[model samples]
Target chain A: MRATLMYGPGDVRVETVADPKLHEPTDAIVRVVQACVCGSDLHPYHSMDATTDGVPMGHEFIGVIEETGTEVSSLANGTLVIGTFSFQDNTCVFCRDGFQTACVNGGFFGSHDVPGAQAEYVRVPFAEGSLVPVPDVSELSDLIPSLLTLSDVYLTGYHGAHMGRVEKGTTVTVIGDGAVGLSAVLASRELGAEQIILMGRHTDRTDLGKEFGATDIVAERGDEGVAKVMDLTDGEGSHVVIEAVGHMPAYEQAYGVIRPGGIISRVGVPQYEKAPVGFGSIFGKNAAVTGGPAPVRAYIDDAIPLVLEGKINPGRVFDQSVALDQVADAYTKMDSREALKVLVKP
Target chain B: MRATLMYGPGDVRVETVADPKLHEPTDAIVRVVQACVCGSDLHPYHSMDATTDGVPMGHEFIGVIEETGTEVSSLANGTLVIGTFSFQDNTCVFCRDGFQTACVNGGFFGSHDVPGAQAEYVRVPFAEGSLVPVPDVSELSDLIPSLLTLSDVYLTGYHGAHMGRVEKGTTVTVIGDGAVGLSAVLASRELGAEQIILMGRHTDRTDLGKEFGATDIVAERGDEGVAKVMDLTDGEGSHVVIEAVGHMPAYEQAYGVIRPGGIISRVGVPQYEKAPVGFGSIFGKNAAVTGGPAPVRAYIDDAIPLVLEGKINPGRVFDQSVALDQVADAYTKMDSREALKVLVKP
Candidate 1:
């Protein structure tokens, strides 16, 4: 089977790898029909982790179940499924409480011992809790993009918006315009946010934001950006400030750009090994800040339905598509901010 | 009028200051009947603020309405009232929302424009908002402590416990042993927290914690304190962590000492300007942290009722008393940690 592997920083290659086979009664072998590069994938791609040899990459996918273990009952041969990026055992106390992402035995694909979906075939563990069946698709053309998003990006944006407590009539200010940020725009809108401000520079980024329902755009950074957003709200700031960029600047800008009793949901993985926090700023305003890796499995049940129903088109995020062999090219384009989301065909 | 004034660090004196008059139409001239020195008083008593010239001090007080402006309708002559430490216009958005201490026009006693209560008379602004009427008590001793705390410490601790969402049967951990922390112990127990831990070193303080409702105590500091708490929880930490000490070490330990999905309410005013936040730690665990100046006006309603009913006995906190002329001795005693709460009589 051909799979995408990271050899080192900026080095992604399509190479023949071991064929995925059922190794446990709770496992299922899936012939991946579609896959895409993810924002998180760029973490290792741009960092030292990309230098690791033969590390299989990619987590998002929609595929057909080629085989199922004896313990698997909900899924069967030919079942079209969306496998969430993180695997979880539904029986855990955390999972039972709707926090499956924090499940005791949860694991992220493409990290450490977990193999990824940028392959001809992949193994899904805890199949019962990991896979969501795609009910019906109005058109075949929509399957790839929608399916590609279920496992990571789209679900992540939904999770981010959810954490921000975005609701109808909420005025949300998204601090980043990355794929997750754009997805947040869609998610916020879906969740009933009346107005959203996409704070970014590039025309390409704002265009995507507009398509997803960003009512305003602030191309400035730091104080100016906060000022622009504050100006938009009569100086009260946004009701919700989504810190999509997990860094000091965005974190600082969020508090400055939000109202006294606002909410800031941060889902971005911090680059600094020890991310700095500002307690005085956060406590002073009586605001709430919370986020984490999207519990894709928890969101897929809803996001997958939206995609299949054609009510949402998260697949439009992919501005370009490339062969598995062109994985490195995809990384180069995304790292340079030239592309929004890229689809990788195995 | 003779008022408690700070001449220099650790130097307090009772001197004649200008008698307060009707500063605003809504202001009431209250003849202070009972006033107490708070742990926070030590901040200025032992701080640079004390080294300054003529700093008026004292926030906690119970008083008689000596005079009321024409527009003041809430009380009449000779009405007994327990004034909130911070004056707020109850009609403002923050006060209407139950955050009176943070009202836009809110004024804290003893700091600049908000005159301290350790005087013969105080200019109580927004009289309707700051005054809580209590039923007459035959035992004058039973009423002073409750009235003193109404201004700051007790209500602040109650607010802290409330913010942490501590409820009946929930386990609670209070991280500071100041007056507010001691008050939090009472608040926790009154609110029905099953087990309360008060982390302190002084025998008097620990005993006070127990008398108030602390079920356990961990005298260790930093990592040792956190480890002891974790051990107390069988390594799961408490369901709620009340951070009363405002510093990085205590703040960090507060986060480390809580289990997954715990609530951390930081009411302590951080001394180091700004403390770096633990973003990932909070997000990954689905935790929440919030709090600021106690909305004294908000909790006074609840606290005053508890006091009148004798459901909560906060009067025990005042371990000593002194004549108003001995303000200097009062400051010195509290600064040396020899007293938990001090009362002053005019």
Candidate 2:
């Protein structure tokens, strides 16, 4: 089986590796049909130290269940399925509360212990809870890319808007121009945000954001960006700010462009541990800060219908696609900003 | 007019100051009936630098309207009223959104410009918006203390519980057993929280907390406190943590004791400017941090009925009282922890 692996920073490769096997009664063997490079992958891509034993890569994927453990009662082999980035029992108190990412029995894929989805065959734990079975899409194969996004990015964006409580008449400012940010623009619109402001420097991405429901785009960064957003919002900031970029400046922009009593939902995996939250920042305006690893498993059921019904086309974010053998090129393209997101066919 | 003034750290004085005069068409002069020393007052009491000019020292008060400017039509002279700590023209967008503390034209009363409430007469700006008229209470004079608390402490506690979304069947952990914390216990009970855990070392205060609504009291701090709360919740942590103590340790305990997907509503005036908000803290659990100065004016209307009917007795937090000339001793008693809170009559 061919699998993606990272040897070190800027080093990505596809090499023949042993096929994943069922290790627990709750596990299922998934024959990957599609997987993608994530922006978070870029974090390790830029700074991961050299290692002789390469790290498995990728967390998002849609596949067919090749084998199921005895304890996995709800799912069957050969069924098309979407696995959330993090595998969970989905019955834990936290999972039941819509925070499957924090499930007591859950663990994220692509870690050293749990080989990743960007492989020919991947082992999914808590199969019944982590994998949502999709209807026979033999003829509706075109929906694959969109369904694949529900594994992570799309749901992450949705989590931002959902946590921020974006709704009708809300003015939402989405920070970052990446796939997640664009997805947030779409999610905000889907949630009935009256105004969508996309803060991004990339014209191509911002243009896509506009198409996705961004009524305004602020290409500026930092102070200028905040000023422009405030100007657009009539000197008051947006009612909700979706922070999709994980940088410190993006966090600053999030707090800056949020109106008094508004919410700043950050889906970006933060790059820094400390940020100002004192009287000078969120406290002064009574702003709330919320968002974390999206409980994609919790949202997958509802999101699948939206994608199946063609209400959203989150798959458009995949601007480039590559064969398994060209996985390294996929990473290079995404890392260099040549591709919004790269889909890999195994 | 006699007023309480903080000349420096450990130096409080009762001095004769010029009677407040209407400085804005929106202003109203209120003759103080009762004003209380707050937990926040201790911030300056411990660190205030010596100066030739003293800072006015109180913000909570219920009083009779001595005079009303031309624009103050909704309120009349001689009417008993409660003024929120921060004065705002409640018509502002933020005020309408239930965040009057962040109103564009709002300013706190104890600042350099606005004389504090611990005086014979205090000028309240945005009178129509800041003052909530109380029904004739001369016959029910006992309710004055409680009504005065609605201006700050009690409302601050309500803000914490409200922001934390405490409701039926929810488990709430309240940090700090100060006036605000006790108020939060009361507020949590009022909001239908099924389990209320009050975290404090003071038995006297915790007893008051229990009386207010705390079902459990944890006299521990730091890791032990976290362990105790986790143990009490069957290792799941509380559904909401109301941070009533504004220090770093309190903030740390807040994140520590919250269940995944819970809310940490901080009403404590944060003493620090930075805190960790990365994966190791709030983000890891999908916990939200929300709260700031209470928009008391927005809540005063609903709270007035509760206090008027004797359903709550927030004024019990005022454990000591002082006359206009004894205002200096009020601060000393509170500063020394000899009194939980002190009510000043001017």
True contacts kept of 1: 0.29
lDDT of 2 by residue, B1-346 (tens): 8888888898888888888899989899999888888899998998878888999988998899989899888897888998899999989888889899999999897766898998888999999998989856862399999998999999999999999999999999999998999999999999999999999998888999999999999999999999999999999999999999899999999999999999999999998888989998989889999999999988899999999889999999999898978887887888777889898887
Cα lDDT of model 1 by residue, A173-276, tens digit: 99888888888898999999998999999888889899999999999999888889989987667878887877779988988876655677877765543343
DockQ class, candidate 2: high
Candidate 1, after superposition: displacement of residue B2 in Å? 2.6
Runs in model 1 lying further than 4 Å from the true structure: A21-25, A49-54, A68-71, A135-141, A273-280, B46-50, B135-141, B207-211, B276-280
Q: After superposition, how far is residue B123 of candidate 1 from its true place, in Å?
A: 2.3
Model 2 chain A lowest lDDT segment of ten: A131-140
Docking class of 1: acceptable
> What lDDT does the true structure give each of the candidates?
0.79, 0.91
